[model samples]
Target: MAYFLSSHITSTLWKLKPLALKTTCVGSVLAVNQRKYSSKDDAGSEYLHRSIVPTMHYQKSLPRLPVPKLEDTIRRYLAAQRPLLDDENYSNTVKLAHDFQNGIGKQLHEELVAQDKMNKHTSYISAPWFDMYLSARESVVLNFNPFMSFNPDPKPEYNDQLIRATNIVCSAVRFMKTLRAGLLEPEVFHLNPAKSNTDSFKKFIRWVPSSVSWFGAYMVNAYPLDMSQYFRLFNSTRIPKPKTDELCTHQKGNHLLVMKRGNMYVFDVVDRDGNLVKPTEILSHLKYILADPTPAPVCPVGVLTSENRDVWAGLREKLLEAGNREAVQIVDSALFCLCLDEEEMRDHIHISHNMLHGDGCNRWYDKSFSLILSKDGQAAINFEHSWGDGVAVLRFQNEVFKDTTERPLVGPTTPPAPIDSASAVQRLEFKLSPDLEHGIAKAKENFQAAVSKLTIHAMEFKRGGKEQLKKKKLSPDAIAQLAFQMGFLRQYGKTVATYESCSTAAFKHGRTETIRPATTYTQRCAQAFVQQLGQHSVEQLQGMLDACSKYHGQLTKEAAMGQGFDRHLFAMRYLSNSKGMEMPNLYQDPAYTAINHNILSTSTLTSPAVSLGGFAPVVPDGFGVGYGVHDDWIGCNVSSYPTRNVHEFLQCVQKSLEDIFTVIDGKPIKSS
Candidate 1:
């Protein structure tokens, strides 16, 4: 249960002598050279040290419960809108549908193209949220591998197993399930009204999240445990029984598909000796994993850092040039962080992925930064958030990018940036907060009840409302695109807007709260998009649209979503889970190690430039990162269209708006 050493400054006593002994409250510590401390020059110092601290057994847990499963919450709140396989005229949404497929497909190719830059971070990129949620969920589900053996002994001083978190910004994660599965045929998550698989789709919705959670649990639960040995999973346990492993939709009559109803192209990667493998290899095996079902799920794990900013400069130069021969001019917008490594295994480090996550690490740091180099000599940034909220995340990313680049948008004169230190004043620490643990516990019960209700009807369940949404149709900008592309489209059109879907079912409140922001943003965007439809001259309209976006962003009807900020505070207190939620945000903390693994990037953004990370997606190429983003829905549907490609279409539509604007005297049109 231990994840950290006490916050009481262990430095005061250590200042008197250089002691090599390890101290741990919670978490792990690699090996220590006890012999070095046994024969210290000053016996008096050793005795003093022993008197102040006693060697002890670990008997506590990390603070803070993991992010909760929102699937049941999603289903219950979304009851009004049907999520069926045939919910939409998939036969009709060709442009958007094909684009969605193409967007992911292109990313597949890019995943290969930029394979070197990717590592463990790729899979994290695949399902950032889901993956994090899974790590935490599985930690408990499988008892957190308490029996699993690690090589390093009692180096809790190196790694107290605490989890540090960073915010995820622009990403291509929604289709990761399908992408990982690497389906040969097109598989849609939204209902397909053209097909009668409504029952199947509904069943999928009901089953997928749980299955995903279990798969992670299976990984943890089923793994081999040799207390004196190392980590190995699946080899100890087989897949569950027919009922246990039965998936909702595989189209193939057999229920053997592991990632049923979703794409399962990516495979799990491991070392030849059957250990968790590196991210670089996982990415290499992606092609084969997509083709073969026998392989395990792949994870790409590697870390990058600003510590070796020089090395990154070289690699970035090479990567930027890796593209077509056209000089690959890139408008780069990068977000970075200063990872403070307090303790762990490698250089005293831990966690997953590239600088995107895993890069913020253990041993590779000086108070200012870490330059942990991989075999390839790339330094990984330590301390990037793997656990901060979107806004908090972006705020930090913006700071990192701004500081690293020497140019900040809030203007250099903005208040000195605050660090997300363990000592950071709690963002929401209010003195008079009431005890809502009971309500939160009740919410969890209700959420579980909702999930069970649907799971019971697993084979026959059907989500609702697709037909109506389909009838209303979606606007061009509703589609997602690489943000920069959306920016470019604005040069041609008078208005350029992005769409962000609110979590339609996060809190107990149904879609109403979710609906409010979507409506406000949608209306404002409509006004802007219509006015610019095919416009040529934009100096004036552009100014107005910018003004309107700023105005619209002020709408806070969707503010209630923040109610569950401390999702497991009550659960932890009641169950006596005893993990401190405010443990330092670091990579070596095992706390950071267990995170949502199958998360596909989705977010709630009101502003186009408002990156989930704040600084916006860096346009490596002239277009956005993945599909030409017309808009970004990630996976939320407060807007009818939700793919990056839809935004691509909107960007093009912006051009048409420019042309139309010339003819319409710069006035946006009213809807017919």
Candidate 2:
């Protein structure tokens, strides 16, 4: 359970980075020129002269992530505890924090700083962050991987499974080609694109040395994020070991892995000379795999990936010993995995369940990522969390969505190329012993039990959103978070610990820092809205809203700047454990335990391409909240285990938002 919590805590932490790039005519122009140049030049030389500044030009000069001051971290920690702890408990916790700050914590902090200084190329959190994910021994299914679904194509005709899958595959290959060639645009947050994200700025920055290029971009209000994780976007899988896992990448492998009805197939999507196969040829192979009449395997090997990590590692060794080494190698080395589901999605809730964690037979959960498509053409990317965060995945999704929708390489009427797909695609078969087959059946049973215990519910608030909140001179995110607080209070009548992720991507190889949203201000504001709505004056309630908004905004800024207390304390505790030191009194306190078990684990991302995203709860009693504050509406997709009522919780959330909007509109709060 702790492993599951840790996976989501770190997984949601990095989704706050804004990686969506603007679609412009200039980009379209560049794409056209790139396609023309590819046709004329050698494959390697095609993108060499396309971009004035290469994709990774600013990586060397990005600033290093900073460690927060010890006193500041302690101060923030105590403040976060104020809302959740009683007076006596808070006092005891404060004393423990004080003693720890002066005693062993100082030594651990010094050691951590020394370690950070020695590793200058990477951020302080990089190695430990990787270790945290790789060392977890739980199944990756609901514990680690998450899904972000793409919106349906505008042209209804293109939504046919075959056409949509083909376009996605082709566009994905094009994205990979552009990224590897250094022609894809760098991931940047432009405060003023007119001045910073311009061709003139690129022409000037191209002359600067790579080591100092980041400064030039920074001077113009453009922030370039670390791209180190992008390398793992392709040809990578998480290999289960006895107590840990390893991220393996086989860059030389050019084949794509496709799964249907529990069977696996692979075919080369890249030609021998290192160029993408024609879209028609790729479509023919995918169509052939879809048309294959193989029955679903009675013992699906893919379900083994959903077992406990150690258990899976043992089963994997047995599989290799049973003369299945070649088949396993093919799976591990494939560029990426694609699942073709037979059922059409009924709606958003159904889509969430299917994409988040499927029946466990058609998905290879250990792959770096898998692109799943339903028979009716709904699509989503369910990615393993160990390799990277949403930055790389979202960028890839944004580009593919744009390319496939705006300039599809294949359409509904396009005919599959006349090629012998039977020879091109290879069906992967594993030699399973009786023991292995029994293990697989057990895995399937366990997976079914796990997924069956989960529930998902979604809601949309149409009364107001980012536009409305901004018009009221309030932070939309703060307001969205405030609704969660009020919703929890309305449902359970108390404020618990909450976590919202904020990215620190401006720094080199940066991960994420936690934004503790269950502050004293929000607690006060939630009480006014939920319990004392009719008693308080409209102005007074509005004032509390302003206070909540202000405090939350400040917390967000601090977390984004990597000054939050969560990661600092987390790293120190991890260090203490690693060094075999005694656990600090502060860490042993019940308050510490309570804060780490976040009941409302929330993350927000808004993109044109992503319809919605979701993850299962980190704890059995918690709610995993994924939301987006759009222009005129705010949407939430939440998940929970049987310990909580997800449906009723969403109802409370809707009412909370309505009450908030009523107050924001300078009207009296209405009682439910």
Candidate 3:
């Protein structure tokens, strides 16, 4: 069965998913191993005393969402998100999702689809964190639209071997469709809702059963939405009849399809609409996405313009020249673009239907791309990140240069530079909180309670869980179980809290966030991912279960509700993890959008860098997401670690469903 998270958890996970890596990277490379300290009475006082000091990296870019309208849009948008799972929309869903894999993914997949395809340099690295935003209201649409209602979540794709199958692949696909519908364009890029009884699209995608021991699964999907309905949603998100002429209104801004950043997209409704009052800016957004921009600055494939080449080669040597002293902090990197945009000739790429976002997506976008064009002297550029990694950026720049007189995208063409705010500039007094102190104390109490006197005696220092998993062909669900129990066994404290939070700065536009009762939410995920191990070895399962049960039970209830461990109350914590505080805040004092425990670019990975190519989104938990180097393998791959702790709350999730086969077949080979 596919276990959906609790309401609070679902929302929290969704929001946290986006900022997972970025937020955690704050205030100097956030140390993953940093110990949680309990706060004294001073925690709240410190927060209260900390006034709104401003910063520059991101100004009060957060304007109030037209309150009354925002509320209405949120309600309507959420209601439209649900799809009937029993119908054939299922096949259509797969067909749509598959487009991502086949079209955009094909570029990366063809190269890294098989292990042998990877050359020596096929390693994945963590790039720095950046904040991109969107503001919505409904004069752009009328009622609330689902995509803009809640903040999108961070999604991670692991290259680990598939172990268990808690939810059927169909469920996973459906969940993906649901997430896609909730985040981006639904109808075109997604499965057509149950319509005719004979849509063959439903028969295309198949679900994997819980049999495999080691499997590899990767999905990069983009769903579509009805253009008119979407436009209605868009209009609602904007301020109606501005008392004064405000907003980045286009005087010279002729409507052209444009994607702001490399990954997120934009479509001009005027161009496609044929007639328009105010040109609509379609932010073809991605929640957990992978894209490739085929037309501008990076497409027409392979060839790079002189200026673009200079930019790439120039950065390679860290040119001492004045004008370009490293826009992105990383000392080593490359940029290229994928030829995925087909908006001009056809609305969609050949892969699947989920190729565009928002309105005008299915009708025209499915056949053509949201092409960037110019009427005035200025030209517009657009593309998807699914083509390749950050390197693809330079490739796109080169394409844009081809049209410019410079022939090389030098002067005005340089896109925004990358920034790593591990060190936000707010000079402030730092103090610990009572909750922090209590959390630390509770963790210890639970640990002590969970580890029965016999655990120490019976536990072997290292019987080799990794080795065992390999041979047993453990599933992802199985790994979650092992991690839950094993992590506890190896942990210094009893209660292992899943660190979950988001970068408040990332989505200044939307006020809704998902994580509530952080403690219970995590505990349940721990149980769900862990307890399912019951299907495996009863002895190991019971032993681990008893320990967690006892730890949670004795750790609270009878224990005086004092000195930390409490079964009832839990608190939400926040930390100013943004480093952009050095600059001045225009509205408030040098204020900054504080990023709390976000996943900044890290120097780590959950597993050893494999040769398989393709991008992986930021995952929920396993390896702690924080700022570090790409070369550093901290929490590199989820498949490498056991997932027990997370599974406890999530209901045992296996690594790769394919891995389950080895276990059931009786001759399980070691994972290593």
Better of 1 and 2 by TM-score: 2
Which model is ahead, 2 or 3, in terms of lDDT? 2
Question: How well is each residue in 1-672 modelled by candidate 1, as lDDT tens digits?
Answer: 100110000011112121111111111111110111122223221011111111110001101111223332222222211211123422323233234234432333233324424432221122333223223311111111101111111222211111111111001011111112321111111112323123333234323342132222122221100010000000111111111111011121100101111122112222233233332232223222223333221210011112222332333334334441221110010011112222232421121122222212122111111222222212232221112112212222222322222221121122323332222211111111122223223323433332222100001001212232123232112222222222333443312222222221111111111111122333334444554444523554445434333332322211222212112211222122223333221222222122111011122222212111111111111111111111221221110112233244434434434433332244544433
User: How many Å off is the CA of 666 in candidate 1?
Assistant: 4.4
Against the true structure, whose TM-score is highest? Answer: 2
Model 2, stretches more than 4 Å misplaced? 1-50
On residues 167-284, what C-alpha lDDT tens digit does candidate 3 reach at each position?
A: 1111112222222233211112111223211123222211222121001011112111111111111111111121211112212221222222222222222333222212011111
Tell me how candidate 2 scores on lDDT.
Answer: 0.82
Poorest 10 consecutive residues of model 2 by lDDT? 24-33
Which pairs of residues have clashing backbones in candidate 2?
Answer: none
- Candidate order, TM-score descending: 2, 1, 3
Model 1: CA > 4 A from native: 1-385, 390-555, 560-650, 656-672
Candidate 3's TM-score reads 0.22
- Residue 45 displacement in candidate 2 (angstroms): 14
TM-score of each: 0.23, 0.94, 0.22
